[model samples]
Target: MCRLFAITSKDPLSPMVAIEALDVMREGHDGSGVGLFLRDLGGPFDDMKDAPILSGIFTEKGIRRLDGFMMEIGFMTKYKLSIKIPKTPPPGVPKRDIYLIRAYEYPEEWEDLTSDEKYSRLMNMRLELRKMGEEKKDMIVFSFWPDVIMIKEIGDPLSVARHLGLDRKDLMARVVMAQGRQNTNYAINLYACHPFFLEGFSTMTNGENTAFIPIKEYLISRDFHGYTGYQSDSEIFTHILHYTLTKLGLDIQTYKHIITPLQDKSIEAHPNGNFLKHLKHSCRRLIIDGPNCVIGSLPDHSLFMVQDRKKLRPGVVGGRPGMFAFSSEVCGLDAVIPDRDKSKDFQPMHLDTAIVGPDRQEVSICRQTEPLPLLR
Candidate 1:
């Protein structure tokens, strides 16, 4: 099993906090790779929250092509930041030529378009750049969005962190998710790394996804471009969250019901049991069948943790007034916030959703039997 660490705070904090937690839980993961996703960014990016920041790695030739493509498409580069990789690479890890984080200004023609339209354009552009780079093995674009930056690499979590200059960099955020991936079902493909992101939704899981194939088919059937890649079975979790919340227009709690719906007997106990029954029947493909613990963050900066119905994996949520941390184990939480209220730290039971809102006030636990809001 892999390990997942996430922290959401009222103030900007270094991802090293999450990294330190992951290091404590290092025994749980094999250290095949590490993926980091940051939101509500700070440091240099704090002032440019509105600009789209494109994060990726590129070859020398790929950099030239990227600039040409952006110029052709009317996005002017406003500012650029690149992570300096260590010259003497970590043992067994390959070095990347360029790791870039660039902020861009949209074309004047796009100034009047709705936010949704601009989002669509960015997604399309990212896909095109990814495909172009894939053909030549020249580049890999992880994300292109506002107030977000994604970094993934194949190596020991701490080693990769050091190689990327994460300790020295000013990169900081109020919300950050990091996963120490253990190669379970697939090869160590960078894209296969955890902490997958699409639009503003990001998710990372700690167990194998037995329901992957069906989930992927259903998501791809929606004709959503971002749903096409299934490099890892866990990728479906992120897409499923996006599909349920954004595409289906359902509330957050309903996301838990869709992925891990209540059993027939339990559903019948609720007032909206009939609606849920029909929902389960219609969206059966979305139901996950595995012992998985998922940690995810929404565009609003809320952080959540969900355990599969079987509760096959281990996870704990703990924190104080100004911050919350989710980890696959209690020791991981202790590493970050040791003085946090131990009485409040509780492991989520089967089919439980633990949410920490943007205010970093308290963690709310919603069980599967809880009556969900009526779908719009």
Candidate 2:
């Protein structure tokens, strides 16, 4: 019963826009936690796009450890934006020494490496930092990537936003996704937050993944280092996306097919029926088996939402030419972009994939019955 809200604009907007929308969408699903993914960054991060930004919470000791580790790894801190928290923060907010987002220059040795190699190193660094933090409860690393910053907190959306000082204009992005978690898992592990990121792909889901174990087993067998963590059942959706795009060279459209394939006659009707049949057989383990709606952003900055056939009214996308948002309820969209034409809003059916290209001009629905763009 989690609420999902994501918006993309031609120009950067403060994260508060999404945060506030999350509040409206919250309804009864308000308190578990809040997770945010900001991409196509604006403001202070625009000039530092090439530098990798490490974002998370840090105890005083953790920050010290992080400084030493970066030096050891050859990363030089270039710029930083440490959120200002008051001595007495909002109620129920956990004690945090520092809420930090810092960008780092790549090690000189990486200058000669290919893009993929550098990405591999970044992922390893994130995992290493996460492992180090877990051992001592010193750091809570969410994302370690270029032009992206993630903030995850266990309080309600607004409280988390205020605690992080998200009202400040310095941190802004053209694309952002916020999730108000339903708290199915009560341990409150921040790592389990939605909108999980890997390499350049990110996704947030709103329902249970009935096929979680099977999908988890399949991803583990891939032996990809990035598929190592499964703190939240929804995390696999992002990995599957990264795998389909990076490993299999399949386009985003193919993702819908792999995760929610058509059966029998439906598949036989597509021009790529044979390919899809073989695909359904080969990747059956990856198909979702229950209610779910996934909202995700690709490396190219395109954003999308997909609904499980069983998920009724999972989400809606509406906005003008320069900006568009997808929300679990239209009220959330109304909360943000009230001026947009209501008639044009799209509520994707069970078989629809609503996508907004990087331009943010319009949402193009890719129905499962239509032929997905050729394999690549």
Candidate 1 Cα deviation (angstroms), residue 158: 0.5
Candidate 1's C-alpha lDDT? 0.88
Off by over 4 Å in 1: 374-376
Residue lDDT tens for model 2, 134-239 = 9999999999999999998888889888877897878999999999973475467888888899999999988888789999999999988889778888999999
lDDT of 1 by residue, 120-176 (tens): 889888888989988999989999999998988888888888778786556889999
Error of 1 at 69 (Å): 0.7
lDDT of each: 0.88, 0.89
lDDT for 23 in candidate 1 is 91
lDDT of 2 at 196: 95
TM-score of each: 0.97, 0.98
Stretches of candidate 2 off by over 4 Å are none
lDDT of 1 at 139: 89
